[model samples]
Target chain A: MKQNLFSPITESMYYILLSLSEPLHGYGIIKKVEEMSQGRLKLAPGTLYGALTNLENNKLIISVGVDPENIRRKLYKITDSGVDLIQIEIKRLEELLRNGKKVYYD
Target chain B: MISQHKLFFAWNEDKEMDYLQKMARKGYIFHHTNFFNYYFEEKEPESINYAADFKGFDKMPEEEYLQLFEDAGWTMVCRYGAWYYFKNMDMDALLYNDYHSVQNKYKKLLLFLLIVGLPLYYQLFIFLPRMSNEALTGFLFGFRLFVYFIVILHFSATLKIFKLYLKFSKNIHE
Candidate 1:
């Protein structure tokens, strides 16, 4: 396993990556994130765009080009690297919960 | 359409947004801005939310960048350089959801200001000394004064933006 340097991503970044498990356009990802977070995390357009650019630059996400239906909107999807990072993050989060539960119960 | 002359400082963009909102309430929908004047088209008196964001199109194309905002319910009003103006009928609509993103925006603006302003100051320094004796008279004197005024304006704006950047940096976690 390669070292997961991108493990500790922000809540927004994590949700964004998770939303792109299936390919999605910018606005689609925003809506999907809201659905996933149950309205708790509203990803603003500017914030989402910034994260998208950063993720693309880091090679965690790749732009799949313009949407077929909408030429204006660009689509993106998680790369293998993105999946690896997210899995690592999930494990780290589980460990955090486990540690907290242990201290609370003991 | 009517135009109102207004002066806005870099640090007080919120105030500019507020002014636009106020204008909209008075049946003057903000159309665009040309230099220091804000142009407006008359419309039914209604409240509108105005937002200003500083973002360059260097990494992303302008069309795609704008389409994202449009999809998020913000209508583009106009753009002055890298500062894009947007409006939404929903008063509660927010273009930025968190402090971290807002902080990053400020950081980008500060970086841009420094990049542009530093070179200008350097050029001014180099040219001023060589022209000092000659520039003190005639058309050169007026030209020197103009340059000084522009530099002073730039310096004040840079200072304001720096303070705003620091504030955002400190509040990033919030």
Candidate 2:
């Protein structure tokens, strides 16, 4: 994985990483992101494709193989590095939330 | 099939998409484009969302690039040069969701124009001034004029794409 990738990734990138808890194809990832975000984040095809390529290049995600149901579609899953990045992001978010709450109560 | 001659500007390709969508609504479904003509076949009038992506078929296999769009419910209409045309029945479907990706597309286009156009312009400017009156007035002069016209077109196209790149760059923050 790139050293500076998770220095606070984009919301789309975070959602995409979270959606890959299971192996999914391009369109499946879009649906998964929408579902995870409660239909608030609908990824466009081009955006998802570009992001997938970037993630794969950075070794954050890896394509397993073609989807059996649809031969034209390829399935992708997050790497261990991806999971580690997500954990770091969650910790960072929690720290921010704790700081915000402290300010709110003061 | 009926063919209509039309000129599409690269920087404002939304106009081309709009034109294609309008034709689809008028029972003239766009088939493909050749040279400066757009060919359309008669079909039932239907509302379609047409999108134009300015990308060359060099980086990845065309099949793989197209499959992604196809899986996302887009139908590939045709590819003219560096432009890929797609259509979908859903009007809300977009090819690009974020400003960054859109800006990157324009940036790539601008870079390509500069790489290809700058050398041609430089060569033209350097060679034109040294040509003697004898060569300037000969049959080659017509060819020279054609070259000048082409260079002018190329310059304008580069200028327009550069402007679009600047506009999209500003929009990335929003």
Task: Tell me the tens digit of each residue's lDDT in model 1 across A7-88.
Answer: 6877889999999989899899989999999999989888997888889989999988889988889899999999999999
- Backbone collision count in every prediction? 0, 0
* Candidate 1 runs further than 4 Å off: A1-7, A102-106, B172-174
lDDT by candidate, in order shown: 0.86, 0.83
Question: How good is the docking of model 2, as DockQ?
Answer: 0.51
Off-target runs (Cα >4 Å) in candidate 2 are A1-8, A80-106, B125-134, B172-174
- Candidate 2 lDDT over B20-50, as tens digits, reads 9999999999999978799999999999999
* TM-score for each candidate, following the candidate numbering: 0.91, 0.85
Output the TM-score of candidate 1. Answer: 0.91
lDDT measured at residue B105 in model 1 versus the true structure, 0 to 100 = 85
Point to the candidate with the largest TM-score: 1
